[model samples]
Target: MGELANCPNCGELFVKGAQTVCQNCFKEEEAKFEIVYDFIKKKKNRTATMNEVSEATEVEKKLIQKWLRQKRIQPGSFPNLTYECERCDTQIYEGRLCLDCAETLQKDLQQTDQPKTLKEREDENKREKVYYNVDKENKWRS
Candidate 1:
């Protein structure tokens, strides 16, 4: 079931459905998308980057990035269309991060997620332990 909410674009109260914005905003966005798509559909603009497309169409760079993330603007169709990597800001045609950043993130997550063995935990505990002994002369020895 849809819920009543304020439109993010116009701040108008509306029933939230497939889009986060209201119907009017959605229509406006659709029109903007058509403008962008039409510009990209031209043979000369097929090699245009996201920045180029945004500048040429007078669209927001962030909005163009969002469309790239959502795959509404297919990068495969345009040879030079690319978005920035979420981590390193490197240009990428697909996903949030480029291959290098993605691999590094995957490796870091894997290292963190790996469970420690009982022997490893016991070894770590042993390394952390310290014993002190007091002799007859009241000298502390470790």
Candidate 2:
């Protein structure tokens, strides 16, 4: 066993072993953990952005990310869990927006299932006019 450290909750001496703190402090921590876990476990709570979790749980985002890295919480179990991009309001699984967003602005480029714009129609007409003019010029020269 390692030397005792002061309990963060009660400032009491706690041995360094399986316990993070003294029994009383451990119990308090356990209770807090359960509260957070339960809040996240609800089906309605399936998807939680980092900001949302921070606002709801009152836990720091950095601390939550740390916990995730440590595997204290299994992200695999939470499929809908996502984080928002600082630049865009895109939902992302890990750090920021989805991989496609990182690569390019696919959402912006996705063609809408609608009619073509006036400019497109005008461009097509111009091409037809040009072809007609070329044929007329050829016939006059011949």
Candidate 3:
């Protein structure tokens, strides 16, 4: 079923579809994509960073980041292009986090998952559980 939604870019009502924005906004974005894509597709501009691409193409950094996240602009083809890590502000070509943050997070998770002491395991086993009797009519008695 289609639902009504407001366009995030222009704040206009539109039928909700696979597109995040309305048709007008989507068309505008396609035009912008062409501009940005053409600017970075040149051999000399293959090494341009995200910031440099945004500046040279006059496109918003957020839009370029969106394109990267959508895989419309592949980082593998452009060595210097990168987006910020989700956990840290460091630039990364792929995944949500850089190597250092991912390793730190993994270490923290491993430390939290250490084996429980014998006493702790015993305490968990000793936790109370209650049982209730039910009448023949299938109703709770207690």
lDDT of each: 0.89, 0.66, 0.91
Cα-based lDDT at residue 13, candidate 1: 92
Residues 8-116, model 2: lDDT tens digits: 6578987878776789966765575676678778877767766777789876665555455556667886665554564676765465455766656665555554578
* Top-scoring candidate (TM-score): 1
Pick the winner on lDDT between candidates 2 and 3. Answer: 3
Decoy 3 TM-score against native = 0.74
Clash pairs (backbone) in predicted model 2: none
TM-score of each: 0.77, 0.46, 0.74
Model 2 spans > 4 angstroms off: 59-67, 79-142
Off by over 4 Å in 3: 107-118, 124-142
Look at candidate 2 and tell me the lDDT of residue 64.
Answer: 59
Q: What does the lDDT read for residue 66 in candidate 3?
A: 88
| Full candidate order by lDDT, most accurate first | 3, 1, 2
